[model samples]
Target: MPDELHRIAAIRDPFEQLRQATARITAAQEEVTELARLRRRVIEGLKDQGLSYADIAQQAGLSRGRIHQIRQQGPRPEGAFFGVGSVTIATPLKREAIRARPVVAVEDVAGAQRLGDLARSLRLEPTFETIPVGGQIDLNRPNLVVICGPRISTAVAETLAQDQRFQFERAEDGPWTLVDRESGQVYRSGQDETAPRNWDVAYLGRLPRPDRNGSVVIFTGIHPQGSLGVVQLLCNNLAEVYSATNGEDFSVLVGTEYDPDSQEPLSVEILTPYHLLGDLS
Candidate 1:
C-alpha cells in the first residue's frame, strides 16, 4: 500500500511540476504581450500626434536607441503576433518592386525596312510607330520601328521625340497588344486604345525576342491596367498558334494609380505569372 501511494505521489508530483511550468510560461507570455501592447499604444498615440520617433522615445522614459531597437527588432510581442503590424504578410499576387531594369536596343529607324520581313517571318503583323498624340501608329508602314527591352533611358527620349504624336501625356485603358514567347498570340486589352500606359521613359527596358533568344527589343508603354491578364492571354494564344510551343511561365505587371495626396505611384502586381502555364496542356 505504501509503495502504491509513493508511485501515485511520484506521478502527481510530475504532473504538478508540469502544471507549474505551464503556468509560468503562460504568465511570462501574458506579461510580454501586455507590455508590448502598452508600448505600441503609446508609440501609436505619439505617431498619431505627428511625433517623431526621437520625440516619442524621449517621452517613453527610454532612450531613442532602445525604443528604436524595440520597434525594429524581431520576435515581436506575442500580443502583436496576431495583431496588426505584426507581420508583413504579403498578398499572393504581390507586384514586383518598383524599379528600373536594363535593356538592349534591337533596331534604329535605319533598319525599319527589315521590320515587315521580320513580322511576316514571325507570322505576326507588327505595329510600326505609335504616334502618342492622336491615333495609333500605322502598322503597315514599310518603316516599322519597334523597340524591345525592359528598362529606362535616353533611347526612350529618342523614340518619343521622333514623333511628338508618340508622346502620350495622359491615358486611361487599352486594347494594347504585346507578343509573348510562351503564347505566340498578340494579346490585347479591351480597354480604350487612347488610355495611357504605365511607362516611365527613365525606367523603361527591353523584353527578350521570342524567335532568336539571342535578340532582344525595347518598348515604350505601360498598360494602365497590369499586363498579367493580357500577357497570360497572349501566352495561351501563342500555344495555339505554334504547335511546337510549350507552355512557358512568365510575368507581366500592369495598372498603376497616382496618389492624390502625395502623388505617389501605386501599381497592381501579380507574382505568379506562370500559374496558368500548364492549364492549356
Candidate 2:
C-alpha cells in the first residue's frame, strides 16, 4: 500500500487550502487598516497646516466630526459612531416668516426631538433651524446633520435634486417615492388617497459638501413615520451601520413598516448596501 499512501500524500489537503484562504483574508484586512491609518495621518497633517475644519473636511470628503475624531485619537464615547459634531433640525415656516420667528410643524417637531435626543446621547450639540420653502440655507458647518424632507426643507430637497445617486419624488395625487438614480429602482410610501396605509421609505446618507466645506448627514422620509424609523435605526443600530460602512461616507435607503394605530415601526429593512458617493461638488 506504499503506492496508495504516496498518492494520498501528493494530493492537496483541504485544511491547508482553508488556512491559506484565511491568511489571505487577514492580510487584506490588515492592508485596509493600514490605509485608513495613513489617511488619518494625512488629514492630521492638513489640520496642522492651518486649514480650518471646513477646509479639511472639504478636501478629504469627510465629516468635520470625523476629522476632529482623528485629530483627538482619544477614547471613543459611547454611541458616537457617526462622529457627528453638531446636529441641525430643519422645519418649515411661512414665506413671510423667513426672517422672523419660525413655526414648526408637529411632524417636524417629532423628528427633531428624536434626532436631538440622539445627538445628546452622542455628546454632540443640536440646533433647530426654521427655513421657509425654497429659502436660502447656510451649508458651511464643519459637521452638520439635517433632519427634514423635500416638502419642508428646500435645502435638503435641493441637495438631493442635484445628486445623481438618489431622487426624492412627490407627485400630486400619488405616493411619495425615493428613486435610485443609477438603477431606476423606486421605493414608495403608502400615502396615496386610494391605497391602504402601509410601509414608508427613508433616506439616510453622509454626503460631501455641495457649496462650502464639511459633510452633511441627511435624514428624510416620505412621511413622519418614516422619519421616525430613520431616527430609530440610527439611534439603535449605529454601531452596526458604522461597521457596514467601514467608517466611510455612505448613503442608505431603508424601508420600514409601522403600526397604523401606534405609529411604531414593526419592522425595518435596509434596502441597499452602504452606497459610496458624494454630493455634486
lDDT by residue for model 2 over 1-281, one digit each (tens)? 56534554455986866676576666565455445545655665576688987898887788989778775663233333434454566655634356655565555577678777877665556788776656566655655667666676556666666556777875565667888877888777866536666688889887665664656677777877787788778778875786576555578898888888878778888987678764355
TM-score of 1: 0.24
Task: List candidate 2 stretches off by more than 4 Å.
Answer: 1-85, 94-103, 133-135, 170-173, 278-280
State the local distance difference test value for candidate 1: 0.34
lDDT score at residue 207, model 2, on the 0-100 scale: 69
lDDT of model 1, residue 152: 29
TM agreement with the true structure for every prediction: 0.24, 0.62
Residue pairs in clash, model 2:
none
